[model samples]
Target: MNTQEQTQLNMLKKALMQSQYATVIAQCDDVLASLTSPEAMREARYCKAVAYRLSGQPDLALHDLQQLVTDFPDYGRAYQEQGYCYQRQGEDQNATYAFYQATRFNPALLAAWQQLEQAYQRDNQIRALQLAQQQISFLTSLPKPLLGATDLLHDGQLFKAEQVCRQYLQANKHDAEAMMLLAEIGMQLKVYSDAEFLLESCVTLYPDNDRAAAAYQALLSKLGKFPQAVKQARRRLQNQPHNMTIQAGLAHALVGVGALNEAIELYRTLLADQPARPALWVALGHALKAAGDTVGAIEAYQQAARQAPDFGDAYWSLANTKTYRFDDAMIESMVVAQHGSTVKLEDNIHLCFALGKALEDNKQADQAFSYYQRGNALKRKTLRFDISRTEAALEAQQQACQAPMFAQPGGCHAPDPIFIVGLPRAGSTLLEQILASHSMVDGTMELHDILGIANSLSHQGNAYPFNLARLSDAQCQALGQQYIEQTRAYRNGAPFFIDKMPNNFIHIGLIKRILPKARIIDARRDPVACCFSGYKQLFGEGQEFSYSLRDIGRYYIAYEKLMNHWHRVLPGQILTVQHEAVIDDLTGQVKRLLAFCELPFEQACVDFHVTRRVIKTPSSEQVRQPIYRSGMTQWQQFEAHLGPLFDVLGQRTNR
Candidate 1:
């Protein structure tokens, strides 16, 4: 949207808030016509719909609300407005459903909660009534400004939410809920350290508050503080022994810490009592798959699908196994579920990806790509990744950390970590598996401490790569030591450990500043093959670019540009390992890798497929067997559908 249109939208929103309904409704169309962005259009339409309903045009309001909700399925305010329209029209059932949807998409919609409370009480929906009552009570009890801030937070207006919360907290520093809400906004903004500090203060002040405890546990987990998360979860469970949520949280923490047996047992125990919960089944399936029991994982995933036919995660979980082939009946069921009444955006995305995989396995290339594209389009709606931010960060790294910056690097000199940095789906995991096969090397899951530290450091006054050059030797050593201390729980006593975090390629400068002696490997692949592979797969978190073909291709180009900068700056510091080279000459590549890391040659690294460890990546199943030639040229089959990707990647495929 242009500045003038955005300014008009801001004015229209204020006018609506002030009950200037005629003005808001009149100005919305002109403001919307000039606004080209989907988000801007959504905001304008919502304002118009709300204004129409308040101005006594119930049918007209419902018409626009219906269109708005259709276009932006996850817009909670649109559903809320739809509820108000339905209520005014005396369509009680429709109002009830709309209010329920509003609350589901955004729990901070106080009016929706109030409406649902009344509807549930009237209709005798006992479970829903209790939930609605709880939600309404929570929302109603908040301070008025915090309440507004809460709604803003739910509506994706984080800047406004932060402003309100900061103003309120300036006078009411000890308000726990306000503190929690602000901390949550910080998390949304990726200001992890600030969020951690706020959550810690909130929890310390209100030790008995379950909400504070829950939020603290969540933030801890998100930052990869798994042991701390486990501790918090255990404490919460101790306080409420029968709380299934706390039990599940602990199970997830256990999985994060690689205590798979305990996590699996905990999930099974939760399932024995609550077998009807499809989410629990899927969680158990994840644990089982991470532990390499594919059969048990399949059974768990299938049971979840059977329990809730519209639960798309279960079907996607099955497809994500990388080796699972869906039967005709299963595919038919997924098709029906995709079109089912309870289908939502996430379900549609999951079903599309699963169906794409099913069709691809059956050699239906065109149909497979169609589903993949649909899934990517839907998935992109749910992410907020910015290619511009990525490019800016890369440019800043180049500007801040040149050869002179590396010259002053007197870091911790810790030779313990071997960092594997690259783009996802570029065979980083395969390299980790091979190196981990060496007796001196321990294969930890893609550790998050590096990214977490980078995030925390970025919150400093100057941001990350720029601030990195200012750290003194002592400060750099302390930060590097902090990393070692934080990641100690994930490692065994091996002299060397592999930290195969692919996106760490972007943080190479920071890595050099902290751990100057660390072994860095840059995993590379054929651009088209890597981009297409990433586009088709669904990641659990943080590889948002993979959701779209053009985005993934552009990310690759950007990644290559940054890596080239690193190579020029650091000379022989980073070893660029092509995925194809390793596949073709395992022995030769293994020896070369060991030579770089200063490890003696080991035959086990060459025969890495047989070395058993818990692999958690999507490549787990494929990397467990010997290398093959089949997947290298698989992108050629879908070449006809990859026009945008080819344009973005400059047609880098050998084929």
Candidate 2:
């Protein structure tokens, strides 16, 4: 709501509390008349409900309260009002239940708690009365500012919550709860490292606090620290062996750590106990797919679809496998689900992307692009991608890592990591697969270590690349060793492992300072094809620029400039592998890639598609097949709607 609307709301609330029912009703009507937003309309309706209740229209008040609670389940005041309506109608049991729900959502609702205590006593429920007493006690024990902050956080007023939390923390330096709340705000703001640090401190200072440990584990999982998350999950499970939630967390962590068998088994056991849970089936499908059991994965995905017909993730999972062909029934189901009101925005987005892929595979280019654009547009609403910020960061990388730094650098001489760095959908995974097929290189997932390190070094005033110049040689060496040690879990005993994190291209200078001897492969692709591919595809995370054609185009330009700088400053230290070149000359490119990494040529490199491993990228299915030229020009089908992309690519491509 706007400032004027909020002022009007406060006035209406005060009038209602003072028993000025007629005034509140009239003011609510006026506010509703001026309000266009649904949230504002709902708040006005709530005020109107209070006026109606005070005027002895209990039934009308109950109707409004029920509708409000239906629309927003977490609206504690609506539940409290619902209880009042029930109490006025002599429905003691219903009043008690509604009051319980009110306190469940917001424990600071002292009036609700008192009403609940009275209702429980009248009903002679001693245990429930004690529970209500404990809740009230807990709320009273918490600082008023912390309580207000908690309420604000629950209401999604993140900035206000952060302010209150910071104020509380300033007064109480050891306040773990306040730190946790601030950490939650940081997580919501996508400042992963800051959140991580706060949660780490909370867990360390309060080791026995399950809430802090659980929050830390979740943050680890979010940051893709699967091994660390699994460690935390294991510790939590040890203390609460029968906790199904913790067991599920452990299974998810297992999946992240590549323990596919263990994850699949845990999921199967969970599914057997909770057969109706579609998420478990989805998890099972992912594990099966990652383990290369395509048939099993298909069955698991189909089971998930059967369990929840509108679960778009299941359908999207099938489509994302890239080998699954959607039947007519499946296509109809996805389209219906995408158009359904019951499906959430996230699931609807998945349905749109799935339908896009299915239609594209069926030769419906127009419909495919429509769905892709729709999905990207929906997902882009949640991201904060700044083109200028990205360009500035790239410029910092160029400026900070001049030739002098490289010349005086003392980096860890560990040539054990083969870095495949570039934009997503740029054949980085393909290059990794080819190199990983060689005997010397172990194939790892897109490692988050470099990104995590960069995030750790980054701050509000100084982002990464710019901050790299401040690191001494000792710090650089430590960072390199940290990367190697952190990545040990993802490797076998192979002398070299492929870290196919595509965005790592932006951190090549940092990589040079740390692991200077590490092999860096610039996985280059045609700008039009690469950008359009990213536009059509839905990555799980990062690559936010891909949601818009213009953003991706500009990012591609910046990426090209940075890569050129790396080549100029480092000179022959990095190798460039063009996607089209690889497709055209697979054998020659394979030899070149192996030679660059100081490896002898092997037939396995040429037959990389046949390499048996867990492929995580969207190109997993494609990399399992021989090279084809069709995908190189697939962007041409959607050229008419790509004016923004072409405008950015002007003078660089023959548009």
Candidate 3:
């Protein structure tokens, strides 16, 4: 290679390391065009392909990798790259074939073996463990016992796996997998510092390992260092440009940092390359919806559903797009029937609840009630909670709020927020839509900011128990400020914001402590009705609470107890919004709700359907329609079927 060529190559390499994908591609393209030596030409093409992959252009990367392997048949790395590209494109068979070829060409390519294992895992093939075992057997000299620990870890035995990893690290302290396993264990245990140190070591030892990079970025995100995580993800993408996982991580980081437009662009590019990836399509739909392009978002979700018909996420996304309650029953039925045969109990519950709401909205009260009963039966088996454990915490929080330990000295300068708290199916979403329609309020559906702050504080030893009374006055004030700051990212200078996480009922004590001045609305419904409603819907993530009926009933009881406690301790701090009452007197209830929120009544509040704000809840369809009486007294028809739940709910039955 000439001096000029070497310099140009060096510059291209630097660009690739920096994740300047476009610059690297341009440099490589020029280098390949001018290359005289066959070796140099092949190398340049490979570099170009890497750059293209990093830039979220997987098809171009695949084309280049395929041409490289064809021309340089003995190049094992070329085959490995081709396999990875194929995997990203969901051509699992082709990916496996390419990995096999790479292994045949070079038995020492452990990365190819790992990729093969992942492809099998993705396909949920039982033979994946056997394949991994086979690959482990091929290693002439095991680097460390950590390899075995990884095998156990991958099989889901975290405690045993971590023990094995710790044993391995005692002898060989520098084992990257051992370090990473420790990190995983730490994360699971909520030991942030231990996880961070272990991840940092793993990344340092194996900079080219995309898994290590991803883990590091995840830890960073968990620690609330989103910008740094984004930077690290971008850097990793430079070398593994065609890496879909990294692309997704980058998009998520961008969203975390409020770089929505850039995240949208990156997601679009990823979707264009891997059009059939339902998760990617769902993400794109969310990004588009957040960007105020509801039509575009709906189309994206529909395309996702068409590509992966059984994917629960796509159905959930579709259910959240329609502009009227009239379509709610149809969407719910479709989702339920689509996933009915599976053992996914939560999805069944979610769908049933959705169906009940839809039927009630359509004035098919008898059918809705039947579904509501089925839903409640399922919930009683699925959802569970410890009321005694939570109530103690609520009492403590009430005392702290009354004592004014954390009250802002000059009085709260922050905007008053209308917080909607309940179980998922208790009409919190609808309340937010009505409130958001008023000129003084902006409904930010189910903001994670409050929960994120609470979680962080809990992890940081702030001495605040899960219940309210345990919080010191100072701690409560700090929590409030932290919540406001975190939510500032989602706030668009609106006078008031609605934090409508149904599960936020669990944190009502802490919420009252922090935002004593804020208005809280407990969206109450018949216990059987609410539990049943939660049974038929399919939540895509983090809903371990809805997998069984007993759990659901227990959860409801805990929520109710906490809400009742709030009423006793923080009188006038909260208002009760009955879902049935809303149905019976839409305008009157809405007027009262507006008065509670301290917002002037506007005609828009009654005609909330005309507002173009993005709705992120399962009730999105219902909220976009005008008020109706169909949802009132919806549990009557299923009275025979829901006897057990009715018995449990007892005198608390709102009906």
Candidate 4:
């Protein structure tokens, strides 16, 4: 909502409290008509419902509340208001259930907690009563600012919550809970290094705080520090031997570090005791997929669907194989599950993406696009991908990375690392597989070392690329060596290794400053094909731009412009490998790639499909098979629906 709309909304709330029901409903309708944001629409409906109830129209109020919760199942305020409607109608059981849902969605809802506490106590539910009482007591005991911030956070006002929490933390230095709240805010804001520091300090200051320890472990996993995540998870498991959640987290970290066999075993052991858990089944499927056991992965995914027909992640996991096709019955099940009143927001998103892929595989192009659009629309809600921020960073790179920065002999002379940089779905993984097939090259999953270094620099008051200008040659050399040491764990006694983090295209200037002797390959693909492919795939994390077609299109344009700038300032330093060219002439492309990297051409590089390694990208399965023409022209079918993508791209390949 805009400033005027927000002010009107506040006024409507005041009118509602003053018993001006008609005024509240009319103004809410006006606000709803003007408000385009999903959050604003929900707020308007919620206020209107309260107005209906206050004006003695219980049926209308219940109708509105039902629709509100139906559309947004996780709307805790709707649930709380629905509970009130039920309570007014003397429907005690319904009111209690609605209150339960309210608290389930938002534990910070004080009114909901108090109601639940009363309901539990009256029903003689001792355990439940104690839990509710504890929640109420804890909430009431918090400092007023923190309590307000908690409410704002739960209500999706992240910026406001951050501002309030930061203010509170400024006053209450080193308060564990305050630090935790700030850390949470930082994470939501995508300020990872700050969150890491806050959580790390919290854990160090209060060693006994398992909550802080667990948060730190989760962050480590998120940042792709798998070995550290493994250590953190193991420490937690030691403290709580039977904690299945921690063990499962450890299994995840194990998988991250290419310990697939061990991770698979751990998942199997967990499933053995909890066979009914669909999440365990889904997670097991991921490990199996990464281990190249496509058949086993399918079985695990199918079993998960069988266990819970409504489990969207299970269906999405199956579709993510890029080889699986959903049968009619499974599609029907998915459609039913998605429309169910209690389908979780996360589950709904999975279902949309899963359905999109399934329909696409079945050759229903228009229908597939519809689901893809819905999936992207839903995913966009939870992200913080600012295309402008990315563009600004790229602009800074162009301005800072002049020819002068590269004149001196600076960075580490280690020529071991080969960096494959590009957008996701631009064939970086395929190139990595081909290169790693060579005798001297090792294949590593997308490494966060460079991004982490840039993030660290940005956090230390000097942002990346800009920071490069101030660094002496010695400093650059030290950073370059630091990267080598950081990535040593992923090497297999090979003279060269591939860091195929696609988004590293944005950090070419940073990579140059640190690793001057490193081989840089730009994995180029058709603009339409690359953007559409990214839009369809459900990546585990990062690449937030993929959630929207226009955002991704803009990102690609920004990347292309940056690459052009890099080439201008550092001529002949980067090689561009076009995906289509590679598909058309594999041998010629292999020769070209090998020549650029100064490696001997080998038959194994041409036969990359037979090269065995831990591949994790969406194209992993496809790359395991021989090169095919299908991927090259797959975007054509969705050409009619590509306007959103192409609108941002000034030109598109002839359809």
Candidate achieving the largest TM-score: 1
Relative to the true structure, candidate 1 reaches a TM of 0.96
Name the TM-score of candidate 4: 0.91
CA lDDT of each prediction against the hidden true structure: 0.88, 0.85, 0.68, 0.88
Error of model 4, residue 529, in angstroms? 1.2
Error of 1 at 334 (Å): 0.7
Residues 1-655 of candidate 2 have per-residue lDDT tens digits of: 6888777778888888899999987777777888866556777888899899989998999988877765665677788999999999999888888887777666668789999888888888999999988877876777889888877765546778889999889889968888888898888767788899999999999989998999999888877789999999999888898887888888888877888889889888888888898878887888887777888988998999999889988988898888899999999999888887446656877898999999988989899989998888878754546788989889988988888778767768799999999889899888988998988889989888888888888773576677676778898889999999999999978999999988899899888889989999999999999999999888777788999989999999999999999999999999999999999999998889888999999999999889988876888878888888888888777777788898998934434
Q: Which candidate would rank higher by lDDT, 1 or 2?
A: 1
User: Global lDDT for candidate 2?
Assistant: 0.85
The 10 consecutive residues of candidate 3 with the worst lDDT sum are 403-412
- Which segments of model 1 are wrong by more than 4 Å? 1-3, 10-26, 36-38, 51-60, 88-90, 652-654
Higher-TM-score candidate among 1 and 2? 1
Which ranking of candidates, highest TM-score first?
Answer: 1, 4, 2, 3
Local accuracy of candidate 3 as per-residue lDDT tens digits, 1-655: 4666666677777888899999888777677777775556666777788888778888999988867765655566677777878777888888887886776655556787787777677778778657665874755255556555554444334577688878878988777766777888777655666787788888888887767888999887766566678999989988888888988988977766657789899999988887889789888888776655767878887787678555655555654553424364456545556355432444455456556656656767777666655654555433223444444655554444443333334223365677898888788888888888877787765765566555555555445443345555576677777777766655567788888877677666566667767788889886777776665455544444554445566667756766776677666778899988888788999989988877888988888877877564667667766766555554555555555555555634434
Clashes of each: 0, 0, 38, 0
Off by over 4 Å in 3: 1-179, 186-210, 216-242, 251-266, 285-302, 305-413, 460-463, 466-477, 633-640, 651-655
Give each prediction's root-mean-square deviation over alpha carbons: 2.0, 6.3, 18.3, 3.0
Q: Is candidate 1 or candidate 4 better by TM-score?
A: 1
**Residue 265: error of model 2 in Å?**
1.3
- TM-score winner between 1 and 3, please give it: 1
lDDT of 4 by residue, 1-655 (tens): 5787687678888998899999988788767878777777888899999999889887899998988876666678889998998999999888988888888777789999999888988899999999999999989998999888888777777899999999888898999988888888788777888999999999999988988998999998888888889988988888898999999999999988889999999999999998999999989999999889999999999999899988999999989888998999999999999888667777888999999998998999999989998988877766646789988988888998898888877888899999999999999989999999999999989998898888878766576668787888898899999999988877888999999998788788888888989999999998989999999987788888888889999999999999999999899999999999999999999999999999998999999999888887888888899998888788899988888788899776565
Query: For residues 1-655, could you state the per-residue lDDT of candidate 1 as single tens digits?
Result: 5677678789998999899999998888888778887778888898899899899999999998878876677789888888889989999998888888898888989888888888878988899889888888888899999999988888777888999999999999789988999999998888888899999999898999999999999988887789999999999988799999999999998988899999999999999998999999999999998888989999999999999998999999999998999999999999998887668778889999999999999999999999998888878776667877877877887888888888995778889999999999899989999999999998888778888788888787877778888989998899889888888888888998999989889889888898999899999998888888999987777888888778888889889989999999999999999999998998999989999999999888888889888888988888888997777888888988898898887754547
